[model samples]
Target: MRTVRIENLPNRSQMHELYHGRGSLGANRMKKILVVRIGALGDAIHALPMVNELHRREPESEIYWAAGPSVVSFLKGHSALSGFITVNKGVKGLFNAAKLVRKKFDCAIDTQGLIKSAFIAASSSNMVIGRAWNSVREKPASFFYTEKVEPQKEHIIEQNLELLEPLFPNETKFEIKYDIPIHEHPEWKFLSETPILFNIGGGWWTKLWERENFVQLANRIDKVLGLPVGIVWGPGEEDNAKYIAAHSSAQLAPPTLFRDLAGIFSKARLLVSGETGPLHLAVAVGCRTIALLGPTAGTRNGPYGKEQITIEPQLPCRPCHSRTCADFRCMPMITPDRVFNEIANKLER
Candidate 1:
């Protein structure tokens, strides 16, 4: 007996070929598009290049972003974005966001790859584009997508751009760049003159380098480079920032928002930090970085710039991706001496 064979559906490129002009929903034809990449600061920053390219390619299309309350301020004033749909905390906020987005766009792209973000995309538009089941952070997130794209790139920024394959089917290359606006904070303007900076906090404990290491690094910079070092911190991190400055030549910087932080990154000669939002922000603004990666690998989440340096530990359990660890040895292994030499070499060059 002969058995009937079943085949899988066409991929993105094949679909494009079959539907190029006949009712194709490419970016060229879309009147409105929604990009759903809600918070965490670093992920939001990574989506910038994708948003910028969408605007660049389809200037007439109204590009909107659905962002979390914390990053709403950062996403605002983007030259490409038409407006924002802020997603506040709690169930009421989600319902309100869903209501506000209902039937509002021709397409919605869920770059966040979380279930909540995918739900936002599904509610916002008829055509939902998202990462494939295996590619997304949450497997369930892919279920809501009408078009599922599996990314071919390693970096988070490049992975985000891969979501646009449906929109720009003919294009293979994209400019992985960010045009982040820099509004110098009046109080933190002194940071522009500071040559070296250290971000003393990474939200996850596993991602944070030792405070004592920062102190040692700062003293080394002062002794050899003769360059002033400054400490940059966010909320709930002031005490640690002060501790580093008090023990060494580093000075504490004023509290500043993303725009102001961008201003500092635009001018600072170098920044030392573990994998965190600020580390990615520095890369976005073209600052040199010595990224101390422990629970995360440099190849995937590290700075995108070729000149940027990422120092990973030699430990076997280095990239455990753990939020909490019994013995967190990776960050400590990246010694102050290693970081200092990188900074000195880069400056000398």
Candidate 2:
């Protein structure tokens, strides 16, 4: 096993190896490709643009995604993707990879670049492209990839996009797009009229701003703009959603499916959320978004799109990306007045 640390984007020679022509002899003849990015919901959503680019570059090639069970539902009805293979994150996941190897994909791209993802890519095929595993926290996984694509930036979306640069050489002509099919549901009828929707939960506790702050912001929006605010929550976040709804003048939307959530977000005037799946989803569908960042840096995992706004307080220790925060002060430092003022300015423009 070899470890390579990629601090910056790959140089021309490295890019040539990773993307230009296919590698040595038989590698160029491969017709089927597997893209593996199995992780947090937001990261999974970010991977869509790259997947779309791959489909465009190789229209006839079968592009299958190896992802976790949680992301399967999002990819279920996508037209650009061939299918998804579920990989559990532990010992059983290795067995799952061995099963996939029997199907025999010609090439695999491990977008996640973790040990588990690398193992799956290694088990499945010989032609693999991914970030050097050593560059990640898990070092031993680098053995899985045949080619290492070092992107120029820290932003995950940009990194994922750079992975496909080899397949398409012309930079200006390559347009990245994610087509999320809208499912018509009467349950989301209220959203058709409501212009603003706010998402209140994410995987990290530290990322969530104070609930009272959200209520105050909602109240201000309702009073100033007269726009109805719809609150969105994931499976385990109903209680928090209810609390926000109870205290604020905003309306509570029914629980939304991942696919349908895109539609709701698309129709909204603006979306306010912490770093979460819905924020990224909203950006994908071209909705205006206001995101609050605490431990996470907006530069890396911020919302992607033209109409997005992010609020992050400046603290020396901020963006520690810690799962737990010793000081809750970082998030509390962001006030309703600052957020509401930004929202007011955005809506006015």
Candidate 3:
């Protein structure tokens, strides 16, 4: 099916000039591309494969990314991106974003299926592309795409790649790689050896394994590997972090930026976390990750690629994808021995 280019958008002649005579970016006007995937770290990480796929297909496309303030900071100055536009979240944010994204583009794709994100892509260029009605999280958002796709794949990462098919139909099955630079952290001086980073999270409470279980796993790792393990935490979870640190042999790792987290992951012997942002980050940076999954679907959101392990609870109500569950035994069902055994198996390699 032919892509439906919107009215008043550039024609093939203008497009040729935009795409540098449908060639590389060296000559005259280089092709400009915009991508919209705003908010929350894990979803953004899942969208990275699409961005890398664009670079591989075009090789010279000037790719721009738009993300929310909290998430934008993580993606700023990323090597894969040509530039970044931070979408502020407030009454005047969209107005500000409309002005920021006014420039014309060769194509615009919104991997984020929210209407706001679709509007951002819509404002950027007329050639907006996104998921079809059935596949999109927000059904109304599909109206903005000039080309809406129905994904054939189940995994979100693969579904993200399917969105690119309208633009580059032939480029399929490329490796998912995040080429961002890992920053150095002097605060990690305590790790004289390859250390384990146990990232604790409070997001999606139903997905979290028991904190006491984490304490047990920490002690087990220390006993088995003779390595100093660290408990990583973010804002608003200080009390819980401290509790885990106090209850186990794991040290309280200093609070970290996304870059610092990248650094930490680069040197980490292994990383353990529930289905959250850091787990995705660990996978993005090629860190060995053990995902303790419960309410979330392990097959869809779990760590992809090698050097990864996922411990999923097989309860009947598990993988409900619900944010809250009163009697959520999915995580509680997981014993420290189960996780410790998985860690030991991963550590042995």
Candidate 4:
């Protein structure tokens, strides 16, 4: 993935034809709006609130989503969305790009401001809006968007909402909402009987805390609270999950689909996790959550629900945001005892 800066973006008028056409469609004109947010799992989840707002503003409009294959399951079966277009980030992605352009979307909103995402948005339609590419960590990608929407602040969810301001009269009045359906699974039925549920893996290894530490924390929680514990793992964390399950009193959850995971988190008395998609999903579904922050700052990516607690180590060198760690110091600084104490305190309240 090559990077492009926002200043170096191509002439904005390249998309003038498309934007004018779509804007002409106006409130009375039925238009197909394509929302593009092909990024990491957590970012994709954050972009959902914007999708919901778009639906509310245009009730009769057709709403489509372009996301990575990893997030397709999450977008599937969503009531606010009419359809989803998969953007496979491989050689096949070019073919997908061609297929996407054929949709003739009136508006293409790129929530992910990377070069690839900008290129997809640019190639898909004339009316393209996204973050200024130079604003991205990697520059040069900005040349693709027809319109650049700069956020007033750094909060990603708020930034996404800012992009839709042009489409609505009052953007702030709209509430942030994510509607992930509840899927019934036998595993969920069994775990529904259990009280506490812990999510054991993040999308990245650096974001994940020590597995043994989580095991110790779960065991201690089970012992102190007299509640049965369960651990949820995503696609590649089965081995880590099994390790935690083997070492702790917590039961291992079966591989869960996106909706099933949401359902399980919603029903759980508590959810303990790192900064991952499921952590946000837990918050979105209105679960009691305790999020452990490591490389990322909790302030930027913390859970945003009513009943949520974030536990981050107060070290000077913490929140380095490094993807690979030679020294896993920040996470190790957060001991199982500390997390357990917080859990007990929250439960007591």
Candidate 5:
């Protein structure tokens, strides 16, 4: 008896490869493509290049991006997407996705490699494209892909570009970088002559560098560097922002939405933050950034271009990828003085 692979989905595109040219009922008429990468603001932002590259190649092809409920507000009515499907983890979200199960998509790419993300891609089409065995975060997620590609890049954005290979033959130039937010945000302009923005949230406890360190850094930037510093906070980090500016020279940034946040990032003279989504957002908008990395490697997720500096601790278990640590020694390894020296040097240059 032969063993059938349970993880592998039935691939239909390969079967019609020879006959599906331009006039047949196979490849010619199939122009609609589904792009799936949802949640964790940074991951969703990283996948934007893939969508832009696809749209650049074929402007007429319809692209549907299945995203999480939290990030969908920014993605709705994006020029690169034909539509947005909101996919939650619960039964209601599953039923919402099932409505499109009968509608056929020519190809669907699962840029996010997870069982949950894989299930969303699998539900939309049989020709689900994903990462190869050795590269995916969850090994089983690769099994759900009808086509799996192994890439040799460490950066997340570069790894995502490899998934679009089967769609385009030969290496594409892949020049264009990030997509700008569609809405214009002139609401919050930088009032100071030289403004520095500090991002207060770093996802979880271990990723956070230290609230006191940020407070000290804010004071140093104002007093020593002669620049105005403002602190930006997300949903649950309001008190952290307040604590950082309590007795310091730091100015609390006005309450702003995600769109306005992009404008703030673009205007800042420098953005100082630990590993987090807004750090990546600041990097995306060409903001000069000083990234403090602890549990994660700067090589994999740090700022991409030359206008940034990333500082990582020399601890033994440096890139442990742990959310919680018993001792929490990594945060202390990076001090306000060390980060300030880098900022002072950049300002001098």
Candidate 6:
């Protein structure tokens, strides 16, 4: 099978229209489907397109999601989700999620491809569909799946869509839809009309670019672009945000939640960040993005937009996908001058 790029595929709205017009999947049989994707923010966000497509194709199915507590605030109000099972790493939370999983479903789909996620899906239903051993992050996870799939897609979003083959076997096409909650805050009135934004954190230490690099970039943006630069930080990142703001022309944005950040990203001019959750969130909200990638493969997890750019180092072990490295040389190679030029070129277009 040939790999398909997300940009080449039709969007959710287009696929929805086609499916409805064809009178596909009648309402008489509503299957109870359990989706298991309990992971970090970016991973959870990538699952949205697949879940949205599932709901679109089978509108009446009771689609339940098992997610981690960290992403509950973000995934709570999705229209496609019939219910959410918050799974914390604690014994109590895990016990509760496992207990809830006992209720049988038509099938459980585990997109995370981890031992924990596979365990959850296995507990939920006898028919568990997941990626094959060679394709999964943890090969051991393949043991739990009743049906293993080998996804032939370059992007993570497209790989996630491939999981639906067992359910919608005859359908050759579907849409990529990201349905996130966008809420306006009164505090947004203070921001410059179209400010260039920066998210300065990464999930892994290896993914983070140097702090001084962000400061230098912010200063350069102020000197050249003349657009107000705002530093957006998540919990525990206030110190970094303040450090960047104090040293450069960029200002620190008000502390924001997931939905609140969506409102901010929707209005922002562009987002400059490393491979992190905020970067993905900005992309999902349609903000122009330039991802500075290091340990992760941009082809699999980079910004989804065709216009968006991902700057990565040319090293033999470029995408080691490691949480930490002995000598982290990848990020330092992506200098402030390099990013600023890309930013200037992107904004000019």
Q: Once model 3 is optimally superposed onto the true structure by TM-score, how far is the C-alpha of residue 216 displaced, in angstroms?
A: 1.3
Top candidate when judged by lDDT against the true structure: 1
Candidate 5, residues 98-183, lDDT tens digits: the string is 45543456677898888877877877776778999898888999988888889878888878888877666466678546765734
State the number of backbone clashes in model 4. Answer: 10
* Candidate no. 4 TM-score: 0.87
Query: What are the clashing pairs of model 6?
Result: none
Cα RMSD of all models vs. native, in order, equals 7.7, 6.3, 4.8, 5.5, 5.9, 7.8
Off by over 4 Å in 4: 1-25, 187-189, 316-318
Query: Model 6 over residues 82-115: C-alpha lDDT tens digits?
Result: 7777798877777778777764565689999988
Instruction: Looking at model 6, report the run of 10 residues with the lowest lDDT sum.
Output: 1-10
Off by over 4 Å in 3: 1-30
Model 5 residue pairs with clashes = none
**Candidate number with the higher TM-score (4 or 5):** 5
Quantify all predictions' global Cα lDDT against the true fold.
0.83, 0.76, 0.78, 0.74, 0.76, 0.83
Residue-level lDDT of model 3, residues 87-193, one tens digit each, is 88874887677677764666788998989889889888757889999988899999998778898887888888888776655556676777766787676874557
Candidate ordering by lDDT (highest first): 1, 6, 3, 5, 2, 4
Q: TM-score of each candidate? A: 0.91, 0.89, 0.89, 0.87, 0.89, 0.90
The TM-score between candidate 5 and the true structure equals 0.89
* lDDT over C-alpha atoms for residue 34 of model 5: 75
Tens digits of per-residue lDDT for model 4 on 131-247?
775455446666776677667756678778888865552446767898878776664555667567788887768777889898888888778888888888878889988898888
- Number of backbone clashes in candidate 5: 0
Pairs that collide in candidate 1 are: none
